[model samples]
Each structure stands twice: as structure tokens, then as C-alpha cells.
Target chain A: MNEELKHYNDRAENLILNHLESGNVSKMIKDASIYSIQAGGKRFRPYLVFATLKSFGLDPAAGLSAAGAIEMIHTYSLIHDDLPAMDDDNYRRGQLTNHKVHGEAVAILAGDNLLTESFNVLAEDESLPADIRIQLVQVVSRAAGQSGMIGGQMLDIEAEGKNITMDELVMIHRHKTGKLIVAPIESAAIIAAADDETKALLLRFAEYLGILFQIRDDILDVEGDMSVTGKLSGSDARKEKVTYVSTYGLNGAKEQLELLKDDAEEILENLSSKLDTDELYSVLQMFAVREQ
Target chain B: MNEELKHYNDRAENLILNHLESGNVSKMIKDASIYSIQAGGKRFRPYLVFATLKSFGLDPAAGLSAAGAIEMIHTYSLIHDDLPAMDDDNYRRGQLTNHKVHGEAVAILAGDNLLTESFNVLAEDESLPADIRIQLVQVVSRAAGQSGMIGGQMLDIEAEGKNITMDELVMIHRHKTGKLIVAPIESAAIIAAADDETKALLLRFAEYLGILFQIRDDILDVEGDMSVTGKLSGSDARKEKVTYVSTYGLNGAKEQLELLKDDAEEILENLSSKLDTDELYSVLQMFAVREQ
Candidate 1:
């Protein structure tokens, strides 16, 4: 990864790990939560938070709490999703999944702990004003709650082994993955106190980025090496779950990714006159071509 | 239930049910969440919120959002606790548990949905000022998260079939059940803007009430009817899990309950000179001699 990306990644990791370590919770739960957290992911969502803030000429450090909170939410979702009752995966990120390491009950509780503590993290952030903190909580809860990520997950599970239409597939991914991806950028906007118009443009840019992220994910699932991707290739195909690749063939999915990249570029271009777009362009490039 | 108690119960029910029914989530999650919410419990925690607010001479309705949010957290914990990997119970409140009705995956998602949305409810509540709402989020999250209810639950699961000391048992119950029970009363104190001393005294009263509540629960498990309690009779003993009854003799447990009741009453008596303690007394009475 580039030095700038590594900086955001390290900051988010330190913030989350420090918070988890200092808590007075049960030792077992604390260990389980920290285990999955320290398991490596790219910290893509935190990058969006930092990059968006930098785009607005604000210090990226201002986005640290929001970045950490979003990453915690992301990590918790992965823990629950890997449970035997859910996706039943034994490996994630080339390591034993949470349930495989901890017992199922502990994994579930660890996920619960992370999810519950995320809101507390935002609420207790002394750097932000009370009102801004509340807004962050509101945005995050809505994105992760029934009408958002959970809702999408329910839809995905329901649609498994059945042929779903492209629109239906998009709807599911939009809810399941899109909302959370949008959350970090939107939170950055709120922190920057961007005007309504800038916020809307950033939101549109985020939507394209979310779809771009998923299409790239689907492509990676088909073409990625297990050593690099840290996932079982073609696992989605094995489950008979519909995806961008399934809906629009592999080549078609790649084509759709290109279109999304172009659209994202245009949105950033529109915002360039008002704000620095260098960091945002780097974020878009990472999303478009990330191998894992 | 008395007329006044019934009123608090009804208001809390309306607030929760209305909020659940009005969401734009997927049908499956919405149905599962509403199913658990509609399953009847005593609405005891909500009663604490309303009763505490009423004690301070504020409109009990002023406590509606906090009351609803706390109840949601309580219900989510119940749903998760009843999962097959956890207690594996098939019934709660005389109805099939969430997992039994909706399957394990949906039940897990539903529990997550309710938990995530709970913060949204408090954050979006315009009735309270922004700072107060933020405070509610912090308190509820802390009480429900790792250091509170979830932590207690982990300790309980860990202690199963093991010989544990009385202090260890107390510590587990304090984290698992005690923190959540204290949350509503502490929330009420915050809402009423009670003085620091008043808040500390009420916290002490809540601590006593939590132990009183657990002792009564242990007694109920030993000698209650399934029809009334909506749980299998003697299930605790059947599981061979330690409880107050198992540590102390049944008679000794009963003595402890009376002592706690008296202690709770004395705290109320002390507060009576400054505030209307009538509703609080009713709450204490309900905790003391309730049959179901």
C-alpha cells in the first residue's frame, strides 16, 4: 500500500486496538473482539473517512474516531457473518474465523460487544461537539440497522440458490454493502460541515464507489488467487448466490466497474473547484483496482 | 396490574410497537423483530423509566423514547440468549422464541437489527435535547455492551456446571442483569436532571433493586408454575446452573429477598421527602411480591 493509505490504516488500527484493550469488560470477550480486529483487512472504509476529510481541507486526524467506529462495525459484521449458522466459513483473511477460534457463543457475544461499543465510541468522542457526535451515531445506526446492512443481509440469505434479477441483486447489495460504504464519506461530510449541495455530490460519488467496490469484489472472487485474496475462489458460485458476475457475466461486470469509475471521477471533478480532490482520486483508484 | 402501572405499560408498548411497525426494512427482519417485541413480557424496565420520571414530577410520557429504547435492548438480549448456541430455549413469554419461529439466521439478524436501531431511536428522538439524547446513547450502550449485560452473560456461560463462589455469582449477575436494570433508572435520573447526590442515591437503590429482582427470579424458578412464569418450571435446577437458590437454601434466599425489599423501601423513604415516591413505591412493590 502507499504511504498515505498506510497512515490512515495505522491510525484506525491504533484507535480501535487501544480502545478495546483499555475496556474493563470480561477478559474472554475482550480477547475475542481484539482477535478479529487485529486480523488483517485493508481498512478500506477508514480510508474513505480520512480521504474525504482531507478532500475538504480538514485534518484527516479529525476523522479518526469515525473511522475507527465504522471499522469496528465492519469487523463485527464479519464475525457474525462467519458463524456456523450464517456463512459457515472457517477462514477469513487467511486466518481462522472468529467462531473457529472462539466458540460460537463467544463469537456471537464478541460481535455484540463490538457493535454495542461502536455507538459508545462515537458518543464519547470529546473532539466533536455533542450535536455532531449524535449525528454520527444517527448516520451509523441507520446504515447498519434493520433498513440497511442487516436488511440487505436478510435479502441475500433469502435469495440464495435462486436466480434473482439484476435489479433485485443491486437492491440487496445496495442495502448490505452500499449503505455502510456510504456511511464513512457521509460522516466526513457532516464533520466538515459541508453545505447541502456538496454533501449530496459526495453522496452520489459514494454510491458509485460502493457499486465499484462490489463489482471489483465479485471480479476478485472469480480471478483472485487464494494466496492473495485470502478467500476461497468461486465460493460464491458454490453457494449459488447471485452476484454482479453472475448477473452480468465476468467481462460485463468488469465493464460495469469501468463505468462506475468514470462516474466517480466525474463527481470528484465537479467538486474539485471547491475542494482538494487529490486524496479522493487516490481512494477511487484503490477501489477500482485493489487485488484483495 | 394496578391502573397506574397499566398506564405506564401501555404507553411504553405503544411507543415501541409504533416505532417497529413504521420502519422501512425488509419484510423478514421486520416480521422477526416485531414478533419478539409483540411477545408479552411485563414491560418491567419501561416501567422503571416511566416510574422514575413520574417520581421526579416530570411527565411520564417525557420518558417514552428512552423507555422504548431500553426495552428494545432488553428484547434483543432475550432473543440472542434464547438462540440454540446459547440457552437453546424454545419458549419465552409463552410463545416460540425468535429462532424457533424465524430460523437461526433470521433470528440473529433480527436481534442485531433491534440492537442497532435502538441507538437510532434515542438519537432521532427530538423530544429530548441533543445533549440529553447523547447521554442516553452513552449510558444505554455502556450498560448493554461488553462491560455490562454481555459481560455478565459471558461470565454466566463460563460458570455453568462449575462450583463458583457467592462473590463470583454476584459479580456475574451484576454485569449481566444488574447493569441493564440500572440503565433505565439512571436514564430517568438523567432525564429528570436530578442532582448528583440524588443520582448516586437512586443508583444505590437501583443496585438493591437489581439484587432483589434476581433473588425473586431464582425463587420463582424453584417454585413457580410454567403457565404463569411462561418458562419451564425448575429449569435452572434442571440445567444445574448456579443461582441464588442453589448457593443459599430456598429459605435463605427468601430471607435475602426480604432484606433487599426493606433496603429498597428505605431508599424510597429517604427520597420521599424530596419527590413523589408513590410511583417508585409501586415499582418496588411490584418487584417484591409479583407472582409472574
Candidate 2:
């Protein structure tokens, strides 16, 4: 990660850890909830929240709660997705998956707790106005709920072991992965109170980044080592789940990644005339080529 | 149920059904979510929301979103609690539990969707001011999350098969069953914009009702028929789970229930001087004598 992006990531991490530590939950639940969070991923979603805030000439600190909230949502989704009934992965970020470390019952509750608390973090953020907090809840819930991430996940599960169309693939990723990516940026736009045009442009940029991020993930599953990726290589293939690489060849998937990167870059160029684009550009670069 | 209570219940049910039908989710998820919801449990929590609103002389419709939201949260908790890794019940409300009908994966996703959408319902309700909606979100999230419902669930699971004391049992029920019970009333108080004095009294009243409800449930498990309760009698004994009956004995638990009912009625008596308490009294009566 770039130095600036790393700084934002660390700040978001601190905010999340602090919030988790201060909650008056049961000891076991608190431990289980904190374990997966502290295991640490790229914090990519949070970085988008902070970067988008900076692009609007707003202090990134203004996006801290939102950044923390989105990361918690992301982490909770991962924990649930790794359940035995879902992906059944034993590892994440090179550590034991939540259920593997804690029992499945605790893992499920921890995920529930995290998902429930994400909205609280936003709703109780005294730093933001009540209207903004309400908007954050609205956007985040819509993105996380059935019509968004969860809906996409259902589609993906139904499509497993089948040859799905490219459009279907896009639709699945758009909701499953795209909504969350879009939500953080959209949340930052709400926090910054950006105009419709800028918000639309940012959303468009996030959509491209979402596709780009997924394609790169497919590519990594094929080419990257488990040591670096922190996920078992070729697990998607083993599960027979369709992906960008499965639908398009590896080379074709890489080509698609390039096109999405270009599209996102163009949006950043257009946005540059109005706001700082350097941090966003770094995020785009990270998405385009992140090894993990 | 009383005629007036039934009217409020039907209104809350319509709001929930309409909201569920209108969501843009996948077909399978929609079916799974709607199936459990449509299975028809008494809308008791929603009644508290509506009744509390009525107690403050607010239109019951004003609490519609909050009523629906709390019921959705309550429903989600029940679905998750019935999962194989948890209580593993095959039936709820005289029908197949969510996991028994839909696969575990879909059941889990359905519960998640419900929980997520519960907040959306509150946040997007145009009738309430943003500040009130924000407060609703904060209170509901706190009540549903780790420090409240989920936290208490953890304690209950930990206490299973153990000969727990009265204090420990109260602590567990206070969190597990109590918080959610209080949240709806608290949400209604926020919606009605009740003064601190009234709100505190309502909260206290709700706390007593929560314990009373749990005690009655325990008594019913031992004395009521499955035909009436829609649950297998002695299932709690089979699991060796601690309950009010297990701790206080049947007669002792009934005595405790009466005490709580009296305490709650006393609060209502105090509140009656300022506002209507008829609907609230009905709720308390139902809790005290409910066969199911």
C-alpha cells in the first residue's frame, strides 16, 4: 500500500479496535468479534471511505466512523461467508477462519453482533448530524441487505457448478461485491455532502473498481501463491464456482481488468477538475494490481 | 387477544408483509424470508411499539415502521436460534423452521437480510423525522446487538446444563429476552417524544414485562400442551437448558411471574394518571396468562 493509504488504513483500524474494545458485550462474544477484525485484511473498503472524503476536500477523519462501519460490515460478511454452510473456508488472511477459531455458534453470533453494531456505529456517531447519520444507515443497510450483497451471494450459491452467462456473472458480482464497494464511497459522498454530479461520478468509479477488484481476485486465485494471497489458490475452481477467469480465460479476465482500470481512471480524471484525485488514483492502482 | 390489540396487531402485520413483499430481493430469499414471517406468530413486540405510541396519544400509524422493524429483528433472532448449530428445532409457530424448509445457507442469509432490512424500514420511514429515526436505529441496534440480545444468548448457551442461580438467570434473561422487549417500547417512546420521566417509567415497565414474559414461557413449557404452544413440551428439559421454572420450580416461577406482573401494573397505574394505559394493560394481561 502507498504511505498515505496505509496511514488511512491504520487510522480506521484504530477506530474499529477502539470501538470493539469499548463495547459492553459478553467476554466470549467480544473476543470472537475482535479476533477476525484484528486478523487484519487490506482494509480496502475503509480506505475508499477515507479516500473519497479526501477527494471532496473533507478531512479523512470526518469519514472515520463510516470507514470503521464499512470495515465491520465487510468483516462480518467474510465471517458469515466462511461458515460451513457457505464457503467453508478454514483460513482467511492466513489465519483460522472465525468458526475455526471459535465454535460455529459463537462465530455466527459474532457475525450477527458485528452486522448489528455497524449501524449503531453510524447512528450513534455524534460527530455527524442526525440527517447524515440517518443517510448512512439507509445507504449501508440497502447495500448490505437482500437487494445488495446478500442477494448477490444467494445468486452465486445457486450458480455454483453451473456454466452461467457473462451477464449473470456481472449481475452476481455487481450485487455481491459491487454494492459493498460502492457503499463506502457513497457513504463518504453523503458525509462530504457532495453534489449529485460528483456523487454520481464517484459511484461510477466505485462500480468499475468493484469489477476490477473481483477480476483481479480471480486472477490471483489462479496465479498468486497462498502464502501471499492468504487464501487457498484455485479454491474457486475446486468448488466449481464460476468466476471471471472461469467465464473468460485468464488472459481475457486480465484484459477485462485493464478495461475496468481505464474506465475508473477516466472517472478520476473527470473528478480531478473539482477535487484532489491523488488518493483515489492510489486506490485504483492498488485494486488493479494488489497481490492480496 | 383483545379486539383493540388485534387491530394494532393486524396493522403491524400488514406493514411487515407489505414491506417484505416489496423488497427487490432474489426469489428464493424472498420466499424464505416471507415464509417464516407469514407463519404467524403473535406480533407481541410490535404491539408494545403501537401500544406505547397510543399511551402517549400518538397515532399508532406513527409507530408502524418501528413496530415492523422490531418484529423483523425478533423474527431473525428466532430463525437463527433454530439453526442446527443452535437449538436445532424443527418447528416454530407450528411450521417448519427456516432452516428446515430452506437449506441452512439460505436460512442464514434470510435471517441476515431480515436484520439488515429492519434498520432500512426505520431509516427510510418518511413519517418520522431524521433525528427520531436516528434514535430508533441507535436504540434498536443496541438492543439487538452483542450487548443486548446476542450477548444474552451467549450467556444462555454458556449456562446450558448448568445449575445456575437466580441472579445468573435474571442476568441472562435480562439481556437475552429483556433488551429486545424494552427496545420496541423505547422506540415508541422516542417516536412519541415522551418526556424523560415517562420514558423511564415505560422502560421500567418494559423490564418487568420482559421477565414476566420469560417466566410465563417457562411455565407454559411445563404445563401447556404443544398443540397450543406450537412447541414441543419438555424440550427445554430434554436439552437441560436452565429456565425460570428450572431455577425457581414451577410454583415458585408462577409466584415470580405474578410479582413481576404486579410491579409492571403498578408502573402502568402511575403512568395512567398522565396517559391512556388500557392497551398496555392488555399486553401485560396477555403476558401473564398466555398459553403460548
Candidate 3:
């Protein structure tokens, strides 16, 4: 990414990181949330939101509410899925799972709070025009609900320990992980009041991004160093979980990522005249190939 | 409460319950949801929400979307709280805990989905004025968040396996159990487009009723019959959890509940002339004394 765009990404990440550290949230439930929300991952998705808003010539502030809300929702899911009852993993982003550190019940409720808490952040944003506020909330509620992330999670739970086909796997990951991935982009477009054309294109971009992102994680689950991934390599071994790498093999997964990235790039045809989100496309490419 | 009100409530409950039963939700999950949501408990809160909207001259159709949403939020929390991970609950509304039958992970996700899906239900109400739709969401979101339910859950979590003062216990229930209680009344007033004066009165009524509702649960936990409560007696003793009855003794708890109920009744004087929420008031009393 160019230096100017890098600055925007850095600034947005810092802003989110700072808010995550704010003292207002009680330490009673803060550590687990703080660990995951502030985990040193790239702010790639949230930045996409800001960039998408900027692309539509809206103030970056116009999208900050959804930006923070999306990130919190993302973080909440990660915490809960790591609990002993769900994915039952121990380490995440190289840190102990929330349940491990905070105890299972608190971890569960923390996730609940985080997900439920998103609306407060979004609604409290007075900067949003009234009409747009309704749209933003409606879109988000749908995405987070059964037809979106929760539905994906249900499919994921049922898909485990089975030899699933590629299509089944896609449905699992798209909902399990893809729905939240799409939220930032769609929310940004909603914030910007992007016309139908822009909304459709950005949605396509998000779909491609979700698959590419999930593929990259599956690949890492096989080869990433423990020091970096925190979780053990080969962790996917026992679940018989379906993934591009699992179904197509590692080399195949790599190729699939490339094809999906290409799809993402092509959709940028709608944004050819735009500048701000161009760098977001570049960032997605890097994310597709990043180390743990 | 009254012949007409009871008849209308039964009609509304059957409407929502029948539609929900026909849903393609997994049979096991569907049954689990019905166990609590359709249990013979009064549907007072949802009834009030619909009634409040009608009092302001809005169509009953406008209330249907939120009716299910609020009930789901209430049901999900009960399911999660009764789980081994949280309260280790075995009984709710005199029925087996969801986890007891559906398995913990499914139960957890079921609750999660219900909470997330509640928002989905609200957002999908395309017929409501966009502004009012957003307002309903904002109100419910605040009532359910950690600062509301999640926050209360946190406090309750912190107090567990410890000796907490009566004030602290009251605070916990106010959010833990009470905000969910507060949601129906506040949301009803909001949906009705009641003026500030009427809205304030409605809130006052909800707050008083909410605390009273909680104190009864506390009292029941101490001495309620398993036949009626659908669980082993001395419910609170097993957890050794602090409760209003535990702190104040049964008679004192009863006195406190009476005070709160009286306050709720006093607020009834200022209710708008068109709003006939007497049935709701009686339901509140029934909810508080159902253990008998």
C-alpha cells in the first residue's frame, strides 16, 4: 500500500486500539475482550469500511461507529467459538482463549455482551444522518442473525467430524466466518449511502474476501509456526473439517486464494474511478498471503 | 386479568406460537425453544408491547415483528443462564433447562442465535416507519447490553461463590433479570410514539414492575414448590447464591415486592387515557406470585 493509505490504515487501527484500551470498560470482563480486540492483527477489514466510506466521499467519521461495532462483533465471535463448548481451542492469535483466562462463563457472557453491545456503539453515533442510521442497523442485524453469522455457525457445528463437500464447506465458512467479514464493507457502503450498484459490487468484493480469508487461515493451520499462530499446527486434523486446503490440498488452497483475489480485483471495476478504497484492494491481496 | 384481555392474549400467543412451530428450525432446537418460550407462563410483557402500540393508534401488525424479538431475547438469556457454564441451571419456568436436553453447545448457540436473531426479526419489519424502527432497536439494544442485561450478568458472575450485600444483589438482578423485564414496557411505549410525559410514566411503571418481578424469583428460589416452579425446592440454596429473600428473609422480600408493586400501581394514574394497560398490571402481579 502507498504511504498515504498506510497512514489511514494505521490511524484507524490506532483509533480502534485506543478505544479498546479505554478505562471505562470494567477489568472484571475487560481482559478477554482487550486481548482479542487489541490483538495485533491487521485492521484490514475495518480499514476496508473506512476506505469504502471515503471512496463515496463521506467523512471517515461517518463510518467509525460501524467500524468499531463490526470489530467488536468479530471479536465476540472469536471469544465464544474458542470456549470449551464450541471449537474448544486453547490458543488464538497467539494468546490464551478468553475462557482460559477469564473462566468459561464470563467468557461466554463477554461474547454475548460484545455482540449485543454493538448497537449501542452504532446508535450512540450522532454523526450519522437519521435515515442512514436505520439502514445501518437493519443491515447489521440481518448480517449478524440466522441468515448470516449465526446460521453459518450452526452449519459449521453440524459439518464437523464429517467428510463435507466443497460447497458445504463454503456455506459453513461464509456464515461461520464470512458474514462478519462482509459487515464492515456493507456497513460502510450503507453509511455512505452508496447506490445500488456500489452496494452490489462491494458485496461481491466481501464474498470473495471471506473465502480467500478462510482459505488462508486453513492453510496456516497446516504450516504456521506455533510461536506465531499460538495454536498448534495440524489442529484441524481431528475435526476432519472441510476447507480449501482440506478438500483441494495445500497447493490447491493457494491457487484458490489467487482466483478469489482475482475476483475481488475484478469487482473493483466499479471503483476504477475511486482512489481511497484502491489501497484496500491492495491490503486484501497481502492478507491473502500473510504469515501467521 | 379480564375476559377480553385474556382472550386477546391467548389469540396473540397462539398466533406467534403457531407460526414459530411451523418454522424449519431443527426439530430438537425448535422443541427446546418451545419448552421455555411457549411454556404456560404469561405472555404479559409482549401483550403490553402490542397493547401500548395500539393505544397510540398504530396497527397491531407493526407490533408483531418486535413481539417475537423481545420474547426471544428473554428466552435466550434464561437458557444461557441455566446452562452449566453459567448458573448451572436445571429448571426454568418449571421446565428442564435447554442444555439438559439439547446439549450445551447447541443450547449455547441456540441462545446466541435467538439473541442475534431477535435483532434480525426487528430489522426485517419493513412496514414500520423507518424512524420508529430505529428507535425501537435503540431502546431494546440499550436495555439488553451489558450495561443492561450483559452488564448485570457480569455483576452476577462476579458475585457468584461469594457473599454479596443486598444492594449489590438488587443491582445484579435489575440488569441480569430486570432489564429484560424492562424491555417490553419501554419498547411498547416507544412503539406507540407516546409523548415524553407518557414515556416517562411508562418507564417508571416498568422499572417498578421489573424489580418486583425479580424479588419474587428470589423468594421462590427460597421456598417455592417444585411442582409449580418445575424444579427442586430450595432452589437458591443449591447455588448458595445471594438473593433478596436470602438477604432479607421471605417476609422482608415480600414487603419489598409490595412496595415496588405499589409504586408501579401509583404510576398507573398518569397513563394516557387511551392506553388500557390494566391487564398488564395484573399480569405483573401474577408473575410476582405465580409460585403459589
Q: Tell me how each candidate scores on DockQ against the true complex.
A: 0.85, 0.85, 0.48
- Residue pairs clashing in model 1 are B152-B176
**lDDT tens digits by residue: candidate 1, A1-292:** 4587569779889988888887675889889999999998888898889888988988888888899999999999999999999989998877899999989999999999999989988998989998999999999999999878998999988887778898998889898999999999999999999999999999999999988999999999999887888878998888777888988899999999998899899999999988899988988998899888
In candidate 2, the residue pairs with backbone N, CA or C atoms under 3 Å apart (3 or more residues apart, or in different chains) clash, namely none
Residue-level lDDT of model 1, residues B194-279, one tens digit each, is 99888988999998888888999999998887778876778888878778899888999999998888988898888887789888
DockQ of prediction 2? 0.85
Mind giving the per-residue lDDT tens digits that candidate 2 earns over A172-257?
A: 99999999999999999999888899989999999999989899999999999778887778988897877899888999999989
**Better TM-score candidate (1, 3):** 1
The per-prediction tally of clashing pairs is: 1, 0, 3
Model 1 error, position B70 (Å): 0.9
True contacts kept of each: 0.90, 0.91, 0.50
**Chain B TM-score against the true chain B, candidate 3:** 0.84
Provide the lowest-lDDT 10-residue window in model 3 chain B.
B19-28
Lowest lDDT block of 10, candidate 2 chain A: A16-25
Error of 3 at A91 (Å): 1.8
Candidate 2 is graded, for docking, as: high
